[model samples]
Target: MASIKLNNVTKSYGHGAKALQVIHGVTSAIADHEFIVIVGPSGCGKSTLLRMVAGLEEITGGEISIGGRVVNALEPAERDIAMVFQNYALYPHMSVFDNMAYGLKIKKVPAEEIKQRVAKAAGILELGKYLERKPRELSGGQRQRVAMGRAIVRQPQVFLFDEPLSNLDAKLRVQTRLEIQKLHRELGITSLFVTHDQVEAMTLAQRMIVMNAGRMEQFGTPEEVYNRPATTFVASFMGSPPMNLLRHAPNADFGGKPGAILGIRPEHLQIGATGWAVQVDTLEMLGAERLVYCRMGDEFLIVRTDESLSSAPDIGATIHVAPRHDRLHWFDAETGKRLP
Candidate 1:
């Protein structure tokens, strides 16, 4: 296990006047055996950042260090890192055992040692029974496990995962996520996983980096990112229904407070008798909870409530809802930055 460090790391294409910069100055320190996840929307530079750490993409400026050694000029293999790609990059003809042993063979490890390594990895990943099966003979989930086993056999200082669970079905994704948690607990190898799925980031990361555009929006534990976002972009991007950002508070009657935006989560607004009066525009029942889309004048917001607490309201019916004062978030309207 090893620590990874990035100091003002950046990436760009072209040069001089025509240069298009993708990653801005991103700086962070990942501790040894830490599981860090980089999450963002598509084309937001999250994957580019991970690739830079893997030495697969060149940094335009600054430095990258692994286990205290600067690796700006090091190749991927020389960096002592193993990568698991989304497509389950496995050999079609080779059996599971051979695919996992291929890397060890390339390094000229003894046959007995290779066998032992493969067997141990298979046992950990529960692939011991399918060692003789080829890639085509296994299911998608099984194939993914084989790919992970191959990486485990390398015993690299760092593990890089690029949307490794994107190809699996919803149920398999959940199952594999559990397996991944177990793997990390047992191996304790430093890992960097990149994904567009916020749920995955929230569930898997010990610390997560939330990216937007080409900048690092925030880096913290899931609770910090979700509870107190640093900016409007983080506020609106990280949640499922997202935060309701309004230019004016409902029932204030004076348009809105100048230079400030109010942010409240869907669950933070409660239906009550004496508060902002809103007309219920729509309602969606989602298992144990319900989403109520409401309108107050021209501003629109959503209210999330438990289905067991009360019955659903009819569309266009007027209802009063109160915002939890403690949960309210304020931002600078012009800069979209959180306010003190």
Candidate 2:
């Protein structure tokens, strides 16, 4: 296990006048054995940052250090890091055991030691029964496990995962996520995982880096990001239904300064008799909970509620909704930054 640190790391394409910067002075400290996920929308530079850390992409400026040693010029193999890619990247021609042992063989490790390492990795990944099976003979989840097995056998100082669960089915993704948690608990390796899915970021990371258009938007635990978003982008991006960001309306009771935006989570908006009036547009029943989509003047709002109510207001009907005062989030309208 090792700590990873980034100091003003940057990446760019072209040079001089035509240069296009993709990463803008990203800096963070990842402690030894900590699992950090970099998450954002597509084309937001999450994968690029992960690749930079893995030494697969060149850093345009600043430095990256692994286990307290500078590795800005080191090659991927020399960094002592193992990566599990989105595609699994298993060789079709080789059996599971051979694929896992290939890296050890290339390094000319002793035959007995290679066998022992492969066996132990297989046991940890529950791939012992499929050691002789080729990649094509296994299911997608099994092949992914084999990829993880390959990395585990390397015993690298850090683990890099680039959307490793993106290809799995919904149920398999959930199961594999639990498996990964177990593996981390047992091995305690420093890991950096990149994904576009906020749910994955929420569930997998001890802390997460939220990126946007190549800039680091926020870095904190899931609870902090969800509860007190740093900016409008984070407020709108991290939640399922997302936080409702309303322009400062002069007549509305939801209080805010003239130039501030009001933010309220879906669950925080309650149906009441003394607040902003809304015209119901639609309602969605989701078993234990319900979502009310309504129009308040020119702005649209979504409210999450339980099914315990005896009745719901009909579409096109008028209803009053009030946001929880203490739960409100305020942002600067011009900069989209959180307001104290």
Candidate 3:
């Protein structure tokens, strides 16, 4: 197990004025045995950053250190790290046992030791029964587990996962996520998981790093990022329906200072008698909750409510709504940064 550090790390495609910079001097300290997720939209450089840490991509500037050793010049094989990719990169011709033991065999480890390591990893991943099965014989989730098992047998200092759950179905994704959590608890290895899904980041990470447009948006626990976002991008990206950001309206007073954008989460808005009048545009009834899509003047809003409500407003009906006073957030209109 080891700590990972990125110090003013940067990446660019070309030189001079036409250079397309993708990562802009990101820096963070990940403690030993901590699970950190780098999350953002598609083109935000999260996967690029993960690949850089794995020594698969060259660093244009700054340093990357793993286990207190600077690894900017190290090859991926020499970095003491194992990577699990989005596609289950398993060999169709190899059995589960051989797949797990391949790395050890390449290093010329003793046959007995290789067998022991593969057995141990299989036991941990609940794949002991499938050791003889080839990749073609397994389900998508099972193949993913095999990929994870291959990494585990190496006992690497750090684990790098690049959207490892992307191929699984919804149910299998949830199940595999739990399996990963349990595996981390038992082994306690330092891990960095990269994904575009905010829900995955929130559920898996001890702390998450939010990225956008080649910049680090925020680094904090899921609760902190959801409750008090550092920027407008984070506020809009880290939630289920996302935070509602409305420009200052002349007719509405959100108690925000002048020239600030008002932000309210869907769950924080409530149907009330004294508040802004909204025209219902649509409604979606989830099993446990409901989403009310409405328009207040020219601004659209989504309000989450409990399913127990005896009556719901009809489409095109006017309804009153208000945001919880303490839960409201304010952001700078020009910079889209959260206002203090």
Candidate 4:
């Protein structure tokens, strides 16, 4: 419901020799109603940044504003933001409806309005049939929905999700992701999500911020971040089994010219009719897909092939592989920066 802004925000802990700076002069603006996701490794300060925006953590420097007004001095409650934590924080003894309505009751909201809001939220979250059930009676996914329902009832200017799906099993996590995406579209509320899972970030975010060691490394749409990674760290972090970055030369050895440090997605490497011969090392079977591990000039690279590649290359067999030139990503080996 509100646009969020952070101007040169920073955070540091301890002092002198023991000092550690987490966020350093981070500046970004989240437009109204946009679903933004902040992604990074475990200690990258992703959650810390979200907590600062929620007013849960006192920012060490810079200013934070919500809906065109500076809210750095305001408390979390005064900011009109609802946060859903990683753990479903429902009251153990409270029923679904009661859990969702607890915040409203504390704010001295009219009982009738609270009832209306909670009921509507339960209906939206498909918990209408289980409002009478307590937290102990619900499954993990259901409890997560209750957590989401609690946030929905508040109708806050912004929604904060702090790794809300990390606890769910893989199947449930996937299911909940779709539900969240649908809920965002239906509510059209600005949401800031924090997660370390690149898959989650890729699937959920319209635009994502990649953070590293408490500093922002890159900010862009999922496609831009994947296709044109800003640095080697991002290049390695955003992919499955990661991108194969091999130190090679633009010479006649591996078929044609190659750049300094060449990055190629596994799926981009394939057996071609005309290419340098590589001695296959191992083969990985992945149901609908397969991976061929091969060696070229003392370097290892993975080639992806669909289930029906017709003639699957055998292990220890010599085969020709051509790098997908158009999809090739180049980076400077020394600086780890993308090539211009």
**How high is the CA lDDT of each candidate model?**
0.93, 0.92, 0.93, 0.90
lDDT of 3 by residue, 84-111 (tens): 9999889889999999999899999999
Cα-lDDT of candidate 3: 0.93
Candidate 1 local lDDT, residue 218: 92
lDDT tens per residue, model 4, 62-108: 99999999999899999999999999998999989999999999999
TM-score of 2: 0.97
lDDT of 2 by residue, 1-340 (tens): 8999999999999999999999999999999999999999999999999999999999999999999999999999899999999999888999999999999999999999999999998998899999999999999999999999999989999999999999999999998998898889989999999999999899999999999999998999999999999999999999988999989444345556777888899999889787788999999998888999989888998999887973688999999888888899989999999988
TM-score ranking, best first: 3, 1, 2, 4
- Candidate 3: TM-score? 0.98
Pairs of residues clashing in candidate 3: none
lDDT of 4: 0.90
- TM-scores for all predictions: 0.97, 0.97, 0.98, 0.94
State the displacement of the C-alpha of residue 113, model 1, in Å, after optimal TM-score superposition.
1.2
Minimal lDDT window, size 10, model 1: 250-259
Report, for all candidates in order, the number of backbone clashes: 0, 0, 0, 1
